[model samples]
Target chain A: MELREMSRLLYQIKLADQRVATSFERETGFSLTRYEMLMIVNDKGVCSQSEIQQEMKIDNAAITRHLKILEEKGHVQRERNVANNREVFVRLTETAARELQHCEQNHDQTNHLIAKVLSESEMQQLSALLQKLNTI
Target chain B: MELREMSRLLYQIKLADQRVATSFERETGFSLTRYEMLMIVNDKGVCSQSEIQQEMKIDNAAITRHLKILEEKGHVQRERNVANNREVFVRLTETAARELQHCEQNHDQTNHLIAKVLSESEMQQLSALLQKLNTI
Candidate 1:
């Protein structure tokens, strides 16, 4: 790809991000980071900081900051593991579960936008390409 | 595609963005917004608040904040155009010109990453697909 194409691709990615961030705030009063943390915690059932860090592949400092945001938002609670004093297990609050449910129910519109933008085959192609990139 | 697939796609986009943002920050000690604003001003060859807003497709408030940051950083300057009493033209400082030259000389690694990750056909197809999406 030429430099111009690279710039446009990056710009498109930014626009997509803005769409999601705006959608989350308008739909659930949650920031994208808060929604992501909730989703990950829910997916894992129960997880620690290390697992979250690995799954997100973000810096620990960024994780710490987002966790603080989540805590302040009352979407998550941290429990100190008695067996491992230094380990903090992150668990979603019931409030988060309710919000996630709402998000899921409202997600159809968002998904429709994406699917309408890219065909099923194209999305699969994009995913395959991205996953390959991730591994490398 | 399912909602899950769309979410994953969006997440991948965020990962790409995070990588780009981190690299841009490290290279120029400037935020993505700052760098982008500088690029726009230079490309326009004549810049004003109204022009920046129209070209960048951002709200006036956002442009104001970014220009303020750029101004404070001493990378940009604005003065009344004299021809238009109510309008001001923004100009890049010598420092900004030098930095842009440096950024151009050091091609963004993210560019190479994109090219390496996507097949040539895939890149062209994705760009066309994204352009269609932007229209909607």
Candidate 2:
């Protein structure tokens, strides 16, 4: 195992991710993490905090901070169920959905960049390898 | 060209990078970027600043910041040669070499992780693909 090679490759991948994330934030006035949160909420509808934490694999405090930021940014809203009381659900605003369609352009460009960097076969192989590694 | 799949693979790569980089920093007490500068200087002794920037493909300002940090950390020293006093030559210190040796464990682990993630053939394919994409 050439650890240095792995480190260098890992660094490259991150640099690319950062480029895309920064673009998304700049274009939409929302952080990449915040955008990801909006995505899950939009897909699953109003859900409790635990679901976000589990799905994103982010720390509890990190999720709370991100949620707070998104709420403040007006992309998401939290409503406390009056009867259930303990259940807090997050909802994406209309603006969030509209922005998502806009943000896809940036995301698509970044993905194309990656695809251009790796062949179609390599992409599948990389994805498969990563899946195996993550599972183990 | 599936952005979602590409993002997943890229995310995994970034996660692995962060984990290894954080460990490297904790063990060596130097930032990953700083360590890379030291390594680059050692490989090509007393090279020009612009040369390092070209090789790293990083923004000049980022390189400048990392160089300053490395010089202050006693891992690197910069000097101006005659001819063009504006051009600087970078040299690595003995302490830097020793520390890099100590911190190399993380690098080795990263390599192991890569090998675990991909076979030798897959590695070659990925390297070739990434290099080609990088040029584009």
User: Could you give the CAPRI-style class of model 2?
Assistant: acceptable
Model 2 clash pairs are: A3-B107, A3-B111
User: What's the C-alpha lDDT at position B94 in model 2?
Assistant: 90
Tens digits of lDDT, candidate 2, B1-136: 5444544555555454466566556655666666566777888978989999987777899898888877887878889978799999889889887767776654555445456556777666555544554553
Please identify model 1 stretches exceeding 4 Å from their true place: A1-5, A69-74, A109-111, A132-136, B24-32, B69-75, B93-111, B132-136
lDDT at position B15, candidate 2: 53
Per-residue lDDT over A1-136 for candidate 1, one digit per residue giving the tens place of the 0 to 100 score: 5444456565665665676556545655566565676789989877898899998887898888898888898888998888898888999989888878876777765356666677777777766655654543
Q: Residues B1-94, candidate 1: write the lDDT tens digits.
A: 5444556666775676677566546655666666677887878776789998876666889988888878898888988889987887898998
Q: Give the Å shift of residue A1 in candidate 2.
A: 3.1
Highest TM-score scorer: 1
B85, model 1: CA deviation in Å?
A: 3.4
lDDT, residue A117, candidate 1: 70
Q: Report the C-alpha lDDT of model 2 over A2-85, residue by residue, as the tens digit.
A: 545655655554554466555445655666566567777878988887788887766889888888888887888998878788
Best by DockQ: 1
